[model samples]
Target chain A: MEQSTESDICTDPVIRDQWYPLRALAELPEGATHHTRLLGVPVSCGVTRGRPWARTESAPGDGGTGALPVIDTYGYLWTSLGEPPPGVFEIPEYTEPDRRSMNAGSFIVATSAPRAVENFLDMGHFPYVHTGYLGIEPHTEVNPYDVEIIDGEIWATRCEFFQPMAAATATGGQMSKYTYRVPSPFAVMLYKSSPVDPERRDVIALLLQPMGHEQVVAHNFLCLLDDVNSDAEIKRFQQIIFAQDKPILENQIPRRLPLDPRAETPIRADHTSIVYRRHLRELGVNYGVVPA
Target chain B: MIRLYDWELSVNCYKQRLLMALLEVPYEIVPVDFFPGWEHKSPEFGRINPLGHIPVLDDDGFIVRDANAILVYLATRYDPTRTWYPVADPELLALTAQWLMFSEGTTNTASAARLHDGLGYDFDVEACRAGAHRLFRVLDEHLWFGEREGRHWVCPSPHPTIADLAIFPDVALSEEGGISRVDYPAVRRWMDRVRHLPGFVGMPGISPPLATSPPSVG
Candidate 1:
């Protein structure tokens, strides 16, 4: 128990004081309460009167700091362990009625939340990890991408890669354009070209719910303009791609994402990951990160 | 056409699929909803194989149940060279059978732990993991020594046999059950050897190493 407690996600202000996804809205039944760990503290969450809420058990003499605020938005129940930002970061495309917003799937990954986020930011692994779907070798090189913090959010633009079967709607290989956003340490989103609706970018967001410093429940949410494929097929395609990444992510040398510049070698293609790690450092995020 | 009652994630089922793929034996998949659906345990499936397990192969109505049994049947019937089953050489045949038997230990321990975590089965996970680690240690030692003897596979054969495929899934996907292979370098190298084999196909949680840059199959 002591070891488990010690290994739970660090509880520093920057890492803990932000909203994290608890579960998808579809899975939550109204009026049920249960406790689950968040940033190392057990918080009870339930839906009441169609409003999801979360609260923690405060010991005596701790005052009234037990009520952790909860909000339901974009098909998930979100809660904060401490002070969250003004609102859950903006996702303008989700409001479009024709755009289908859905849950791709959720997986329990035995690595730090940051590792999962970094994997989303990486396209070099696509040729290898995602294989034929997102990329294939001989065409494996990732074109130069721009990474910078815009208004305090990490953004990577101008990223592109060639993929065989880019999506459920993909009929053949295409040079897929990619844009990435890291709104927080554990959340990353990708805007890739919609194979069916080439004019519109498909949104795939991976949010990490940190169960511990070295473990997380990764929730994949998709907002896409694709009407050619059924929801089930879309989910299946995303799940297959993610399943391939699972083995590689789990087999990484260290379970925690190393923030130290010298810890892991970086190449030109890892520009986004390198920038994201720097952003994490700027935020003073030590949870789920290797000590320098 | 041969039909296999298969689940993509099951190591036992995957071995049959892997062997068939390696043998280049084109077959149809009778997808069994083994997880949330539990179709394999149904009365209808019970008629196919009373054991209520998957990887039950029906080759033109000749039914073969169990993973190893199907492997034995396929290698004997399909391989013209007969290098896989080695029926002609008694010594190699005994060694192949020995490793195939050892593969079951991996299934019961490592794969059982995966079932508990991934599919929510009732299992003593700690015990399962401990048993798996014990088996992996012995496996690592064996592979390490075999490399020294210039034997690339579990069986001391010039070519890989059914035993390699049988054990590959359980050992490769051990991390799905939180069993890390970091300590077993020799075992890791052996899995890579299996992955680089022509016609190698990966199920969920298994993929060829990125450096090998092989295969379009995800």
Candidate 2:
């Protein structure tokens, strides 16, 4: 991947035009209007006639000034600041009849959205940060994973981890198989082995809305095939995992993720992260990225 | 009829607007130019509130000043459901009052920092930011354990009280003042729950909650 300077990434217009999920469609209350910031633009979103809509605000106090097209798919309300791409990314697992869809709710992080997405792709912090659940001291090794860019999307397959508690309903240790994908600059998806049914993998997606270059609102979506745990339990489990990650993301120096190879030393465990950053750089995402 | 001396961006004034919205009370806002004009400090406005605050409340000629005091008055008089204040419940009432005091600390620190940054108020920005973090840490830990016990709000009630509204604007808008809430996940989740309440509204910094679909059942 060609390395780009900080200026190139900030001026990249493509990132602004891509569809970003603002919130979960089911989570938005009826007749309720929500005010939020997307791509540094103040926006108001609400459902009208059973359809979700979003528009940018011209003034701070006034309501939405211009209408922006909205799409509801994969259980989220998606919008874009500029012209949106053709359609939202599709998750095949969402169609499974037995899988229960869950919204883990939204979290506002002080760090840039790209950094937050990078953190979601990182498994090396599982043992230390997530403690006994996702990882532990003795099982800290992140085995070699296969990373490839397919049709412009970054994918990491064959990733594996030893988890003491793989899921909220988990009671014992297990080896979890994983596959990570970055379908968009600010969005990431992880498919991992389900504790209830190892044959059926659980799909978790982190849909991020960049409020500014240094701020983001992360919306987590979980598609799980579990009969033992309630929907609330699943949402809580994801919240706990992300909550453990929030502090580390916030404290990183420079706030934005560095794209230059010399910015920060990467160990072998960061292979996926390295590839993800390179892909972001290649896509000219510089809004929240810094140079070495 | 209730009249609120209001400013659009003032977090203190937002406290009253939020509570009144949650209670579904009707009120008219007497707009006070708190920004470039500094209308609240003007002699004419001082006649309404000698303290020169923009959130003074007048209910049919009865006057109330200060954000928390107005919350108590509004809830006590307007919330016929009695859940917002819960004066009948002694333990919950005390807890509510305690958090109301806690909200004052947040206002002095978090909201104060916002004043310095957004309105160019002269204050020790770093000191205010640090103070806000200290308070947020305490509240985050408190709310984290509260979730474990199934206590969603500050006062241990299933329904949110005035205390949540009191502290929400400052905490929600802390980012504008350079205070990061990334460490306080429990507080962040509580903000979502409060936003999900019926009749909830958003100001400049506060965002409304998404529509929640009922949990999928077997």
Candidate 3:
């Protein structure tokens, strides 16, 4: 099926065993439960003693046995459906003393989680989809970037692009270097040259929560070492850039990602996408993907 | 000489520019950085208009503040056909005024939702989207009946009035605010009509019909 009409939960152990970020801690107040869905299963999250907790919708509210494993790390409240992960993945930059870390809101995209993650990894769209911000026309050519799987995580290094207005603190056009990492199937992070300090790079992560087989909530988190640009300015930059991708994501032909070989034509620029699909296939992630 | 305090992305500001363009009125833009900069809200801009909003027009120091009001002034002063404002016909004038009021509802909801999404304005986006849909439903039914009765514009007239220009930007750019116009067939057709209007102009998000003409060819 091109698009799942009803809730299609991926019951694969590979998927359920992995943790998904349900919501950011900023979304929940101290004593209120925010009802949400995870991989088409109803889930609720509430904060307790400054620590967030999540429970499946069918579980008892008084903290009976049904409370799913919750981990408060990387600026979000992460939970799992089946066997819990040993620990959340590492992001040493998140703990940097001078970094300004914040939860940059969640966006509801009407597409599969993989499709959202792939869009995060795609840079060819920057010159068009994010015109005047990330990149612009005539400077649309994607230079050679290196992509490979390192330590079970896919990395695309040496990626660079020209951005007229790269970030909220951008002064002028600068050739920004980018390093993309796919730590989990549903998460992608990019380390780009800081607008002020080119020697240092900024971190922006897109954590996908598959509400259904064809619906995903993209939680944006930013950990940056910036002496300028207030919280509102940084958040606004992220919101505008992500909002521009919403129409393009929902209007995709397949709605879900196609992983079968030869399903899509890719160029040298799409090396990251090609490797990402192969990585997902090897992991047997059939939830929001079409593998024919 | 006419001067417009314009923001390139503001739909309300586009309403004025579109009307002036259609009326063949020459105007220069005094650009205001509405987003990121908030130049419109600055003390320097407040002296121009105490309201601290954009799309303000000055015709040799005779100022017009609101987008709809500027549309009325432009059409009444420039267009010789008198069909845009129809000041002579009380019934048509009243009808045009009614739809202009309808444009206010769309501007507040549809365009406001776009602001919340793009510029980080704090608004209840769900309510903004729902309110826009309800107004669009009313507009679609009206336009559908109008099309059946051989009327194309929002008012019952042979040609478009300021009402069409006033509401065009909000409905055209509704998707930017996550308000889909797929269900409103008549509204889409009417928007197509407005896009093909003589001397029609478009701002950032609102573009004219494709496969019909070429100017800003990439």
Best by TM-score: 1
TM-score winner between 1 and 3, please give it. Answer: 1
TM-score, candidate 1, is 0.76
Give the interface RMSD values of the models in order: 4.5, 15.6, 8.4
What CAPRI-style quality would you assign to candidate 3?
incorrect
Give TM-score values for chain A, per-prediction.
Answer: 0.93, 0.93, 0.94
Report the TM-score of chain B alone for all candidates. Answer: 0.95, 0.95, 0.95
List residue ranges in candidate 3 displaced over 4 A: A1-7, A59-65, B1-93, B100-138, B141-170, B173-186, B192-218
**Could you give candidate 2's per-residue lDDT for residues B74-176 as a string of tens digits?**
9999999898899999999999999999999999999998776544466898999999999999999999899889888888898889999999989998887
lDDT of 3 at A165: 93
Kindly give the stretch of ten consecutive residues in candidate 1 chain A with the minimal lDDT sum: A1-10
Each candidate's fnat, listed in order, reads: 0.19, 0.00, 0.02
Which lDDT tens digits does candidate 3 get at residues B59-128?
Answer: 9999989889888998999999998899999999999999999999999999988876544466888899
The 10-residue segment with the lowest total lDDT in model 2 chain B? B209-218
Q: For residues A234-268, what per-residue lDDT tens digits would candidate 2 score against the true structure? A: 66567667756766777788899999988889998
Q: Give one digit per residue, the lDDT tens place, for model 3 in A24-95.
A: 776566998877677767778889878788887652222334688999888789999889678877989988
Better of 1 and 2 by DockQ: 1
Residue A149, model 2: lDDT of 91
Model 3: how far residue A61 lies from native, Å = 20
